[model samples]
Target: MNNYEKVLVALRRVIRATDLHSKRLSKNAGLTGPQLLIMRTIRDLGEVTIGTIADKVSLSQATVTTILDRLEHRNLVYRVRSTQDKRKVHAHLTEDGADILARAPEPLQEEFIGKFQSLHEWEQSMIIASLQRVANMMDADDIDASPVLDVGAVLREDGWKETKKKAGA
Candidate 1:
């Protein structure tokens, strides 16, 4: 294959790895990456507001709220209204939350982050620069993204089909 084809294949493998990991997490833990992330944040922060969790995780409040709603429904988290400021809501982890968290698999980035951080400063900077350049080359530099490794966090129930329909409409 040509250089371009080789690059494409390598990229696909990386993407596919992420996709497969996401599927495994969903099947095994019944939690999306963002959900696990929010759970961990809640556990770490004690009683934190939705905005705080969103800021900590680099996710939008709306997205966090949506996932929090699901997590709350699952009884993994509960929200309490602030007594002093009744309008304020805070997230709290439940017993089940703590138990599940103790068993959840290492995050998708756990291995990657460890190895990436072990590289020398010069090598780290070079990788970051190269990755940024590749993102720009692919016209994805400014896309809203979180540090979470889960791909298609925004997709739900064949979002692609709906997007295709809208594009052709």
Candidate 2:
């Protein structure tokens, strides 16, 4: 194949890998990537505000609130208005949430991060630059994105439903 075809193939593989991992996570852990991420953040931060969780996860507060609402519906998390400040609410993982999180597989990015970090600094920079160039070439350089590596409309509460519909699942 030509170099450009090779690049396209590599990008497709990355997307497919992310899609497959997301499916596995949803099947095994019963949580989407963003859901697990938000829950884990709440667990780690110990009664964190939605804004704080949003900052920690590199997602918008509105997106975080949506995910939290779903989690709350599932009884995985609960929020309480701070007594010291009624306007500020804190999120805490319910017992079920913590239990599910403990059993959930590690996020796909965590595994990638470990391997990426092992490479030489120059290699890391080259990879970053190359990916940035690819993004620019595709006119996706200015798109809003977060650190979450999940595929689909991760910003929406019904994102997975839309993905499934697109795939005719």
The TM-score leader among the candidates is 2
Residue-by-residue lDDT tens digits, candidate 1, 24-44? 888777888888889999998
What TM-score, computed on C-alpha atoms, does each candidate reach? 0.86, 0.91
Model 1, runs deviating above 4 Å = 155-169
* Candidate 2, 1-169: lDDT as tens digits: 9999999999999999999999999999899999989999998999899999999988778778888998999999999999999999999999999999999999999999999999999999999999999989997654667778898748356545544555566
Q: Which regions in candidate 2 have their CA more than 4 angstroms from the true location?
A: 158-169
lDDT of each: 0.82, 0.88
- How much is the lDDT of residue 54 in candidate 1? 87
In the predicted model 1, the residue pairs found to clash are none
Model 2 C-alpha lDDT versus the unseen true structure: 0.88
The window of 10 residues in a row where model 1 has the poorest summed lDDT is 154-163
